[model samples]
Target: MKGRTIILDHLNGREAAALMLDGQLEDLLIACDAPAPGTIYRAVADRPVKGQGGMFLKTPDGNAFLRQIKGMAPGDELLVQVTGYADEGKAIPVTHRVLFKSRYVIVTPNAPGINVSRSIRDEDRREEILAVVHDTIDTVPHGIILRSSCAAADDKDIADDLISMLALADQVLNDDGKGPETLVEGDEPHLLAWRDWVEPAEVVTDEGSFETHGVLDAIDALSSPRVELSGGAFAYVEPTRALVAVDVNTGNDTSMSAGTKANFAVAKALPRALRLRGLGGQIVLDLAPMPKKDRRGFESALKAALRADSIETTFVGWTPLGHAELQRKRARLPLTELLN
Candidate 1:
């Protein structure tokens, strides 16, 4: 994903359009416009019609801005410049826009679907939450869920985000301001909220040294599931060429039949390989071709082994070449790829 910076004059639609068209902004950041706060929008530029270009802005706040003009319009034209490469280092255009002064607020039910008639003061905070919510709701509805952030938030956080927005809005609102206006900006990319939510069993990384500070502080606070530091595990990568080979070693497990043990080993190794290698596409599994007496035992053992990983594996019977075929879900990267 590419990052961007934008400036807008007040809540002028024309200025927004110019920045979007010129910068070819893919994502937009609006500073103000509370009441449906933190709303992020996507700008779709219509194909040039007879030398005239137009743009349509779709925001979660149920607001849209459209512009139809052949060239630039007057009065502080939206100025947007972007730096990002796409598809073989080609410049892909993106649209960015900001609204000055207007902040947003979102009124979510205390308990989803349970709307209560409650009023919250702290105008400063209310406006801020509204603005950010309005911008974020469109793109990341699932991401920014209404948590304690709104509960007794006293609008403190709201005020903070709002005040921050106002500072940016004020800068753009100023007529004497020299540089391009920046209506809104996103925070640093880190899973602060995720850390606050899910308590992982443990967080192991290869970064070395285990001093929990800064972003990792929240991870340290988790109880029940304590976080531990350890050197990263080894990762295995898949072969790039079309043809690849996997040699299965039985090692030593005398407790189970040879065929059953072999099947279990293969099943146990599949998930690790899939994840580490970032492997996609089809995967073919060749189990040790065992005698007829062990055939049923092998199939049963394979099924049992797959259950441990919560992955579905089909026997597909046996092939003429004595190989077993199975299908697994395709993940962006396989475990083996990452491990390698």
Candidate 2:
């Protein structure tokens, strides 16, 4: 019930990971049936869309669409990485910028250089990691990015991680094969939890961990649109085909500052709600009636909340009719989509 707990489990026979903090479900990642993000493929350019400046690719799985196809021909063969899931009937979204990701390092084949994460500000630690990188990945043609997790890791372990990533990068980039094929499948849920969730937490691998830790009950609450916030405030997050709509309510608070209080609570809770649901794209917020003077505070609160989120979100400013707008990246499939 304190700190964090990373639970490696399965949901409906598919791999799934859950992060719990203070006995509450904080985040989750579930592997879908389609190609996972970060999967590498040797793709052959098929045909280009007329006005979209995009090209369809042929991979072993299926057709993928890559935008920004400069200097690309229809018959050329190149490597691509799956960026995210596709719309219901669209081609899988792929990108030419394929990155080799690992627990401690990320190998960039396009750019060759050694860089450390900005979060590691200690000059001594940075220099120590750099020395390890030089010793392990010397004379490499590809780029190396030392992730922040290496800051507290042992030098030998960091070196080993770098070596592993470098080897994978070399194997994929230097492939001389002619036909289309999947070079590397993306990390499954258990592996993804081990790689990305960097906080110190209890690793719970026992089967039925989800139900035992109340994760299943929390997920059931997520199915409804209503999200109960602190201090008798609540918000409804409903998704439609076009965009997501959120409405905040003061709920039994009759004070003059009730609206402001409710809006602030929504600001702090919105990111986690969207993240757990895997909802993205257009989001419009309708707040309870509040003073126009409180707009700046609301924006600042929401901005601080979104900063902690891993998803890419653009705060597109407030609407003339007193609604907040945001554009979030469609990274993971909606939790509802996977659950249903």
Candidate 3:
């Protein structure tokens, strides 16, 4: 594993932590900010946006977008899940489709199915767990996805989590008279990311962060725009108004294979750096120039590095300048914003 270390660095005056992985700061989840993703809210369709497809929803926490107009109308109460955070007066993206996330499983209300995590690679174990989940899911039209945590969980744990999630969903569904009300608050960002994406072997936190949920250890990494990879390779990250650019350069004193090795090193470290920095939207990686024929190998390495990211990412292929172009979904403000 290229980026395996995990550290929770507490920040000053915030109920949040900077999740550092392999010396890069990845995400910032603040307790006082907008609702976390997976948070369920009871909202009413406040008004329809003119010429736009979706209507604005008034929730207890903030305004959300219900991006369909056909079956929804003003003053109609509905249950929605937060997909991303928003700035003041900006509507957070939301979905009527809800997923109740827990450490072990995600229960979808009124939908009946069982999907296991792709990370669960054991076929026999998957089948066995699927059997367990299937037997546990009864009567409710709820669907379930047994997360990676299920691999370590017993039958009782799975069953209990499932029942609790289902019960919560039912409660949200049956509740009435809502303007903007949070039905459920979500877990901290670090914890959520750890459960959903990277399963770190260890979690280290400073005394302050460990005690008060602050992020102090990741300050330097989160603020710096450079990442030094193994061997003599490094990346200089610059965020511009249009996009973020990463220039990969080789260090002093190298071998004939240094270029290829450096490119491979960048392929591994670049994505981890971008992810940890939470620098999304358009991203361009300027390489140290390699043979066109070897481009595929480098590209594959980059894609493999980002395989575990919870955010959706798309590789737009290489650029004419021997650079790689990619895009990641942007929801909340960049992680860099918090550091500043």
Q: Highest TM-score, which number? A: 2
Q: List model 3 lDDT by residue over 244-284, tens digit each.
A: 89888888736776677778998777765776566777888
Q: Single out the weakest 10-residue window by summed lDDT for candidate 3.
A: 209-218
In angstroms, give how far residue 248 of model 1 lies from its true place: 1.9
Better of 2 and 3 by lDDT: 2
Off by over 4 Å in 2: none
Tens digit of per-residue lDDT, candidate 2, span 174-230 = 999997899999888899899999878999999999999988998888899999988
The number of clashing residue pairs in each candidate reads 61, 0, 13
Residue 125 accuracy (lDDT) in model 3: 83
TM, every model:
0.31, 0.96, 0.81
In candidate 2, which residue pairs clash? Answer: none
Judging by TM-score, tell me the better candidate of 2 and 3. 2
Ranking by TM-score: 2, 3, 1
Candidate 3 lDDT (Cα, whole model)? 0.72
**How many angstroms is residue 314 displaced in model 1 relative to the true structure, after the best TM-score fit?**
6.1
lDDT of 1: 0.34
Better of 1 and 3 by TM-score: 3
- The positional error of residue 50 in candidate 2, measured at the CA in angstroms, is 1.9
